[model samples]
Target: MTTTAVEHGPTMNTTATAVPRSSVGLVPATATLARQKISAAIRSGDVIFAVFGPVVFFLCFYTPLHRQFELGGGDYAQFLTPIILLQAGLFTAITATETAGQDARAGVHERMMSLPIPRVAPFLGRMAWVVVRMVLTLGGGLAIGCALGFRFQGTIVETFSFVLLVVVFGSALSMVTDAIGTVARNSVSIASVLMIPQLILVMESTGLVAAQAFPDWVQPFVRNQPMSVYADTLRALASGSAVEPLAVLLWSVALLAIGVTAIVVAGRAQVKR
Candidate 1:
């Protein structure tokens, strides 16, 4: 009997060793969380807003200003499309704050913490939704712009850069807002506060009207502000012209750095709580 037990032990050990241990991965975990976010956003109608927000914003600006801008020289549709895309990205970021806030209020983060996934999965999951919204906004904006006379005048590379820049800009902002939402209780108030600055930046920007159109006192600010710089870079890329893109690139980098740092801190805080 002892001899038979010993022999069986070796077989059992071998069988146990042959059975693999299942491991979770970041990609699959993030994907699952992302799908959760997408479904929630759909139920909340945030997904619908993603496609229509830019459409409404684009038409709002294009309808009244097109004739005047066109009369100034170039087609207004081509000139105005860049800012619309940028605004779409901003809108995506704004929506992220509210969603993140909702999750925080509902103890979603705490629930997720109990899982064996990476701590950064929640942020990445929300960002995946942000990208989806940005893509939807881009399609909607471009479609409306094309119908209104906008066209891609640049080479494939420049056009691609134009799209890439918008994504980077939006993603950076979304990260920052996500971090803000994770820690803050009043996310809706934060979102409302964000809009004031957003409106100021777009209205005072060279986006809708040339810098010269602004009062002389504000022209310098308008020309050199971050929004104007981004609009300029977007316009250059869209028109296949050469201009200094370094400023906007620098802005993007700075925002990304801030976002990364903020998000890391926010995640660490969550772990502690």
Candidate 2:
């Protein structure tokens, strides 16, 4: 063929090359990714960080700190035992934000967007890790609590239900953090934004200090905050008393709603970028 003809033929062949078929967004075989993520979380100190607060809570009660107050039942360890679980939920959510930010910065999130895996898969995968991490931490907390003479006052089923409540809520909280991370652009912002409110409202004792003694102005809002509900539920669990089913349901739904809204907003921002 002449030079012009040769060039034209190759151009035609280039256009004729088929685009590879994309994978259907069917559920991915995510077992391997799940394992890898879980291993990484453990190796990266995520789980260890989750463990620290619980251990510290245990020790605080096991020491002179318990003498400062009645500690309800005079067994500060038991009182703090269930609270360790609340702390676990709080810690995982806070940590997930920074981790998610790192993943985004590393281009993992951007890369995933190019794939055919369902958009929800990444969130679900992270959520699965949240559960695994929370459960492992909860188990550790419980073990330490038991070792320190904190016994579950409820039936096995009741105890499991309480744990389930904590895990479900914790996962929802983690999703919120993930969405926040998507928009944070860096780790420091993530920490500053997510950690502060959590510490002040949840971990700190503005309302928890004196549930019945808060200032009238703060009482209304503090009573409705998730941490307050968490503390109450924990007290119930520790004492083997009935937990408020409605409170748990309401708080869980509220958190899930916030997370869902955040995810949708973050997804839009990500796509725009």
Candidate 3:
């Protein structure tokens, strides 16, 4: 017998190859999570609150105050629409922050960390729902505004762009709130920390009133702050005028950076623990 003829063939590996994760799955997963979150908000009656708050403000505050005070020409309702929409956005952010803080304190992050899903998925899902809530609130406010004589004087494109800007501003504000939420000890702390600054900015800025209407000592701050700049830009966009976009851009970028940094830091700290 020839020993060379008895040589065995090379062995084949029996282990199965692991399949790579598909990016396509991420979209549906994120969307599903966002929908679930939004449904929860609806069940909690937050959706009703978000949609109605602006309408109430428009009816009670803007309607009466616009008549009592000159609001830089045009229908006062038109002048006040942007601010109402902006306020609605801010309210959405506040709600988001409170929810996020509650989740963090309840150890939701810890549970999430054990899952195979991407780390940012939950945040993105919450933000997606925030945008949805904002749209609903803004839509409700716009209907109320129209009933009160608010009209879009600009082209359809400009009108859409104005809405887009409000959404962008709201999204940026939400990020900042999200950052605060991630690290805050509780919902009350989140509210207390954010409410004062929000009031100072929105009330003192050109949102509700013109810079000239403010006291001379505060005129400079009112004229130059991010909220004022945003309001001015949105006003111009709505009425078809020159927009100074720099200030709004800078504010959005700066806040987004801070928000991202805070979230990352908080997440890392949580993970380490």
Candidate 4:
């Protein structure tokens, strides 16, 4: 019997070593609570800012531009609709990262960390919330675009193309903004940091002056920036013109990659207390 037990022990040890351990991650209940809370908060504010803001901004442009530009078959408001949607989207893209910073400041993140939830919960949960807000915000903008006389130029195929472009690029911007928020020491810092991109990089330059009015370098960059491309695509869709679908797709993928890379780098820099 002793000899038999010794022979079996080697086999038992081999089997034990071969069976893999379960990868540690967020417990079901904790993950559920985190997702629910984040989703609810984003949905509320996201609708208000992304949808309502664009609606109001479009109304202001309708009357004045109606008399000015002879936009072929469409009015100035129609031309401006997609641009306004892009603008509204920018406002809500950073919602998640901003909320995460708030959580960190409030000790919520630390409290969650103390529980059995996976270390990635805080990061992934916030990103999920960002995506939710993006949908709400961008959906609202699309509704506003329809109200402002924007319509799909072609079949259902083209409509999907426009939405795909918007979502991808919007998500990229949101991710980049989230990374910035992660690195920001406090809420004030995050707000202050976004001012440059909000005021300068993203603010409307379309239809204001001739593209030639700017320096050669500035002209091309301004025209091809993410917001600019989205606006251009929106206008094309609304006017029943051929849109640059490939350019938008390329830009969207590139932006998402860049934003994700930045977030990972910033996350690694974070020191656990």
Candidate 5:
């Protein structure tokens, strides 16, 4: 009787809503972002730069240097082709600065942080363009080099090695430059600053001239520097001659380590805002 007289209380709903898993995976997000970057590069004439940058550089170097190299009993086209391929990678790195700077200025990274997709997707997307640009530039550079009498005297494996070396160096350089672009306040200024070192390294390297070609005082720096080592290694690969593979491997590893370090440091240094 007392229970019946008690006032009835309202029922509380105990049903819980299941949280949904994310529909977008990291791979798809990275691919989508990469496509976006590639498209932007196309719209901005970056594609043209990728294909023609090496062509212009090749002509500039070869036109003046060919007779000189030939006079010295060497084919400049063969001697110089490897460096042009490597420079294509350098060009790619420089271009990455502008695009990465644009993204930083646009608040794209901040927007990305709010999404469920992996944060690294956007960076990986930008790197995909680096590979594409390097490839395009390599192809164009090779075509021009071949037209000018550059030939691969190496076996298929060595030729492949030659190519792999160029791409790897370019990729490492791109990674460093891209990270710089992302973190630097003024990417265009960064590019200009890099150009000086680029010119110095290429000009002083055995790629453009023999170690003996430089003055005795600078020869020590010119002969053993990283660019010179890379140039010498690439020449060996193209000529099907033996080189210290361990040295090239060490250089590659060092370059890659520097690149990865740059990316990680830049990511940590980046402001999510």
Candidate 6:
């Protein structure tokens, strides 16, 4: 009778298996991706272009124009430094459009979606790499500027502030281009679509020539456009004067919002496909 104990099935282990924590945060992961992107750019010779492009432009324009024209009563090269820096950022931003377009055309985004990583990681990674290139371009431009008699008339803080403004604006513009690239048919198409607007902005802005220099018909547009505002603010940062920083800030925010919306739309479209 006592031996009638029910046979026990396999006893379950009540110990909870601990889930291992991931050591990487978004910053580190994004940084790793940034490094990878930068390495790829270096391998592709993008670094060379980023470094030398501003130098060449500086040589071509600054050398010939410096003695002929004095802007704001200072050397033209000094006056042109801000614009040169801005141009470097612009050129670096172009890579974003090309790379994003290529990724979209190649179905790279689709493959990335299958991975365990965050969806935004790739985009942020590309942006981080863009910043790296921006820095390089800035450095190269500054070096060339220095070589060509461009000096910072402002204090060190002012110079740094000028750099910050340029980089931030460039980054905003890059995000806009990134979104455009995601939807564009190809890199060439992205370039074609962006070229006219960018050219207009650069050529008509107060960075290269005074707003007063523009024809009467175009002066109104040149004086009030976002690019003109940015160039004016940057010029002020260089030598100190009245500038419309608020306008540039608002414009940057608007561009960033548009870019984010475009990326979301493009991502949804990709998912549908």
Tens-digit lDDT track of model 2 for 1-273: 656543344434455777996764434525445666788887887777676667776675457655654544465556666667777787788878877787788888887777767776777777778888888778778888788677878877777777888898788888888898878868657667766777677544422254555667777777777777776776676668877879868888988899999999998988898
**Span of 10 residues, lowest total lDDT, candidate 3:** 20-29
| Segments in model 4 whose C-alpha atoms lie over 4 Å from true places | 1-35, 38-46, 71-73, 207-218, 237-240, 271-273
Poorest 10 consecutive residues by lDDT, candidate 2: 203-212
TM-scores for all predictions: 0.90, 0.82, 0.86, 0.75, 0.90, 0.85
- Best by lDDT, which number? 5
Clashes in model 3: which pairs?
A: none
Q: Candidate 3's residue-wise lDDT over 1-273, tens digit each?
A: 666656689989999999875443557767877998889898999989888888998887775687656633547776788888887877878887887887788887887766667778778888898888889888888899889887777888888888888888788778778767877777667777777787778888887777888889999999888778877877888788777778877887886787677778867766788
Question: Candidate 4: worst 10 consecutive residues by lDDT?
Answer: 5-14
How well does candidate 3 score on lDDT at residue 23?
Answer: 47
Give the CA lDDT, 0 to 100, for residue 166 in model 1: 86
lDDT of 2: 0.73
Clashes of each: 0, 0, 0, 0, 0, 0
Candidate 4 is scored at a TM of 0.75
RMSD of each: 4.8, 5.2, 5.6, 7.8, 4.1, 4.7
Candidates' C-alpha lDDT: 0.86, 0.73, 0.80, 0.64, 0.87, 0.79
Native-referenced Cα lDDT, model 1: 0.86
Q: Give, for candidate 5, the lowest lDDT window spanning 10 residues.
A: 1-10
Q: After superposing candidate 2, which stretches have Cα over 4 Å from the reference?
A: 1-29, 70-73, 203-223
Alpha carbon deviation, residue 34, candidate 2 (Å): 2.3
Sort every candidate by lDDT, greatest first: 5, 1, 3, 6, 2, 4
Candidate 4 global lDDT: 0.64
Worst lDDT run of 10 residues, candidate 6, spans 20-29
Per-residue error at 75 for model 5, in Å? 0.9
State the lDDT of candidate 1 residue by residue for 1-273, as single tens digits. 455543344433445446654646889988998999889888989888888888899899988988887776889988888888888887788888888998999999998777778777788989988888888888998889889888878899999998888888899989999999888889999988888888888899999989888899989999988788888998898888996877998998998999999899988888788
